[model samples]
Structure formats: C-alpha cells, structure tokens
Target: MPPISPNELSDEQRPFDEHVRQVMGGLRTPFTSTDESGALIGPFPVMLRFPGLARPLLEWFTTVTSGSVLSPRVREVAILTTGSRYGAAYELYSHSRIAAKIGLPDGVVAGLTAGQRPAGLTPEESVAHDVAAHLYTGAPLPGALYRSAVACFGECGTAELVFLIAQYAAISMVLNAYDVPLPPDAE
Candidate 1:
C-alpha cells in the first residue's frame, strides 16, 4: 500500500494521524516512524485507514511499550523471535534496530532475526526466547518451559512476556498482510 501523506488525510483520519504522530514523536525509538515528506511509515498509515480498529491497537501498543513489566532486552527478544517466525519484514527491520539499540549484541540480534537461538543470553533472556520460540510452533507451551519462565521472571513477568509475544505476533501479522515496507533508508 502506498503511504498516505499527512496532508492527504481525511477529516476522520486526521485526528488519529495527529495522535499517532504525537505519540510516536514523543518516544525514544531507534527506528524512523515517518518518511521524508512526513507520511507515517510502516503500519501507521495502514492503521490510519481504519481508525476504529487502529485506536485500540494503538492503545494496546502504547500500553505494551510503556507499561510492560519485562526488561527491554527480554521484550525485544520475544518480538524478534515472533517477527522472524512470521517473516514480517518491517517488524523485523524495526525491532532489529531496537534490539541493537538496547545493547543486544549484533550476533544475538542476527540470530533472533534468523529464527535461531543465539548463545550468551542471560537466564531471563533465554526464558523469553524459549517462550516465544515455543509459541511460534503453534503448540501449547510445555509445562517445563512455562515453569522455568515463571521461575526466572515470576508469574507476573512471565505473563507479561507471553502477552508481549502475542501482541508482537499480531503486529507481525498486520505488517505481513499489508506488505508494509521498511523505510527508504532500509534500502
């Protein structure tokens, strides 16, 4: 889908567009959320096309980013694993940068983006990756793995990890379904 420029937004889309721009602009994100002409990049434009659905999803996204109990590294690991599993290009592209920015080694980021378990993870990070990897297989998470995650992260943190995986998986599906491209700089 071609990007909808800010100037081209309809009345209904304008408010949501402004909300998105304001929220994204306030974040310390590692990736670009807009293009040279200021069109929303990645899934933002697609979301603007359906404000009813986008509003809640954006809320969930904000909550996930702002209110999550998991560490940034753990969250990014789960996201990269899920995004790679779905082959969601934009998802992978964006989170790969985030993963790096948060001090995840290049090799570790590369491995996650390739859907492989990278070595040198802390116990918490390993648990996060395993949880996401197991979920990617479309099977129930094994009892042992779930127990381990709980042990490492506590029940609340583990639950947050699982929810983060589910959220990113949904985001990945959206990016893939809409064929959202990486920013022009990605080329």
Candidate 2:
C-alpha cells in the first residue's frame, strides 16, 4: 500500500468526521472525492457536491440485486475487465479485493487483471468482458455481443449490464482525469 492515509486531516475534519462517523456507525473513511484525501484524489465528495451520481449508483445496486445479469462472480469479472481497459487504478484497487472476498479464484482474478478474460468463463461473463473491452476502446458493440448478452442475461439484464459498465467507465474517467491515486492499504 502507498502512503495514502489521511494523516493530519482529522485535525481539520473534527466535526465533519464525527458527524459522518456517527451516521455511518463506524470508523468513517472519509469519502475520497471530498475533503482531505491524503493521497486518494480530489476534494468534495462526488455525490455530496454533484448529487446526480447517486442515481446511477442506486441503479447499479438495483440492477445488481435484480439477480439477472450480475451474479457476484460476474459482477467482479466485469469490474475487473473495464478497470483494466480504462487503467482505473482506483476501481482496480477496490474491486480486486472484492473479487477475492466474493470468492473469485486467485487464478481467475490474476488472469483478468492482465486483460486475458480467461478460458471457461460462462458465456455471459465472456460477453460482459468483450463488451467492456470494446466500449473502452471506442468500438461499437457488435450485434453478436448484444445477442449473447441478451441470451445469457435477458433484455433487462443486458440493459443493466450496459448501465453498470457505462457507470464504472464514467467513474474511471473521473479517477483518471484527476489522477485519483489509490487510498493507502485500499486493495
């Protein structure tokens, strides 16, 4: 882990930190897009200031919980796929650990990180990776990709998968634009 801890921040964030800690009911890691990030990135929580970010994030949760396109394993795979294509250090740091926590085998995660989408992936997972790669690289999603996605996930699931990919791609943009380095010990 890099030296990204928020040292000297609590000294300035006493009240804000306390309020967030009480509300969130734990050691509130300061939202990186706001306040002092130590080494994370930016200031002003993306949602707290921008507000509109909540809509897509909520939709992402809803779509994932919809249990159509986003099995936990598949979800992690898609995240890793786009994170690599976009070079999203932040999402990679976060989701790599999550992939492990959600039970992705180490070998699979390692392979995906290298942009090799691995053999033996379920068809749906394979298409999700392909879609992510194409979208990141500025290619049109071919009909075959959409058809396979729909076949595996159905129409709604395909839509949700696209939504998730687009949302995370936007997030990757923010991080990359701002050079949002990873939080210390984050992965």
Candidate 3:
C-alpha cells in the first residue's frame, strides 16, 4: 500500500496521525517515523486506515514501550526474534538499527536477523532470546525455560517479556500482511 500523505488524511485520521507522531517523537527511536514527504511509516499508516482498532493498539504500544521494565537489550532481542520469525521487513529494519544503536554487536544483530542464535549474549540476553525463540515455535514455553526466565527476570519482568514478544508478534503480522517496505535509505 502506498503511504497516505499527511495532507490527504481525513478528519478522523488526523488526530490519530498526530498522536502517532507525538508518541514516536518522544521515543529514542533509531528510525524516522515519517518519510521525507511526511507520510507515516511502517504500521502507522496501516493503523491510520482503521482508527477504531488502531487507537487501542496504539495505546497498548505506548504503554508497552514507555512503561516497560525490561531492559532495551532484552526488548530488542525479543523483538528481533519475533520479527525475523515473521519476516517483517520494516520491523527488522527499524529494530535492527535500534539494537545496534543501543550497542548490540554487529554479529549478534546479523545472527538474529538471520533467525540464528548468536553466541556472546550475556545470561540475561540469552534468556530473553530463548523466551522469544521458544514462543515463536507456537508451542507452550517449556517449563524449564519459563523457570529460567522468571529466575533471571523475576515474575513481573518475565511477564513483561512475554507481553513484549506477543506485541512484536502482532506488529510483525501487520507489517507482513501489508507488505510494508523499508524506507528507501534502509533498502
């Protein structure tokens, strides 16, 4: 789908667009949420196409991102794992940059994008990756892995990790379904 330029947005979409820009602007994102022409990028445009549903999802996204207790590295590991599993190009593109910007090594980012488990992860990062990898298999997280996650992250952090995985999985599906392309620079 072609991006809907800002000028073409309906009254209903305008507020949602503004909210998206506002939220994204406040985040330490490695990506540009709008293109050079000021169109919303990635799933933002797709969400704007359906404001009723997008509103709640955007709220959830805001809460997940702003209120999360997980470390940025853990969050990115789960996100990269989920995005790679779904082959969500934009998610992978954007988060890979975020991951690198946050100091994840090039090899590690390359491995995750390729859907392989890379070595050199700290114990915490390994647990995060394991949690996401297990979740991607569509089977229940194994008892051992669950215990490991909780042991490393505590009950609340473990729960947040799972939710993060689920959220990124949903985003991955949206990006893939819409065939959202990467920004021209990324390509």
Q: Highest TM-score, which number?
A: 3
Q: List the residue pairs that clash in candidate 1.
A: none
The best candidate in terms of lDDT: 3
Better of 2 and 3 by lDDT: 3
lDDT of 3 by residue, 57-127 (tens): 88888877776788899889889988999999999999999999999999999999899889978898999
Query: Which tens-of-lDDT digit does each residue in 1-187 have in candidate 2?
Result: 1222445334444334333334333323323323244322332233233335444453464445455546877777888898888887877776777777878788788888777878867777788888777788787789988888888878887787777788778777766766766654654
lDDT of 2: 0.64
Q: Candidate 2 clashing pairs?
A: 33-44, 34-44, 34-45
Is 1 or 2 the stronger prediction by TM-score?
Answer: 1
Please give, for residues 107-175, the per-residue lDDT of candidate 1 as tens digits.
Answer: 999999999999978888999999999998999999999999999888988888888899888888889
User: Ten residues in a row with the worst lDDT in model 3?
Assistant: 24-33
TM-score of each: 0.95, 0.69, 0.96
- After the best TM-score superposition of candidate 1, give how far the Cα of residue 10 lies from its true spot, in angstroms: 1.4
